[model samples]
Target: MNAAATTHHHTSCLRCGRKLTSTKSVATGYGPTCTRKVKAAAKAEVVAQYKPHQVAKAEELIEQGGLIPLRGQIYLAVSSDGSQTYKTHRAACSCPAGIKGLHPCKHRIAAHILSLAA
Candidate 1:
């Protein structure tokens, strides 16, 4: 038996239970139409929806040394392991949480705050 065949990949869409046909749909568990809908909805969500509490958390982490401000408008927020560096800009970040779904992530908010203070 093939390893991929036994990997328990999605056979149907989780949202509507539609039978998955294409390989990409099977892998994502959502067909192109539904995927487009989801992406549209997500893109419509404004960055401000990230909430003030989440911004506070980002600030707290910065205070705790998880984020370090570098030269110019750039800042580096270290991951939990303190090994990987995530570059944060005034309105964006290199982190997945910053780019995925919504454009501005918590790291971006923190960077914005720092920018305003400066």
Candidate 2:
């Protein structure tokens, strides 16, 4: 017997008990008549509404060598280690400013400035 014929069959949606035309297993196949469509639509809506400003800020940081200087001799370094998903990791100079609870140090700021000039 074929695999499809061997599988157990359920003809109603698990969520709403409506007649099921298709399962959500396949990529492009029709899904459960109501809940599947609603869930998928909601997911798309959330993704579409993402903020562009935050994305642009990150790109600017990349262009600037992932380094920023705030005040005095403080420097900050931002790093990431993920393909599709980004995980921000920061490193700072070991200057007194950093050790005293201030963000970044002078070394990172200098590096960033040099990188920008070049």
Task: Write one digit per residue (lDDT tens) for candidate 2, span 49-79.
Answer: 3344433443334333343333333334443
Report the lDDT tens digits of candidate 1 across residue range 1-118.
Answer: 4321232346776445689898877765556775555444433442355575766665554444454546687877765444466888867788878768364666776566555443
TM-score of 2: 0.20
Evaluated against the true structure, the overall lDDT of model 1 is 0.58
Worst 10 residues of 1 by lDDT: 1-10
RMSD of each candidate? 15.9, 20.1
Clashing pairs in 1: none
Superposed Cα deviation of residue 28, candidate 1 (Å): 41
The stretch of ten residues in a row with the least summed lDDT in candidate 2 is 81-90
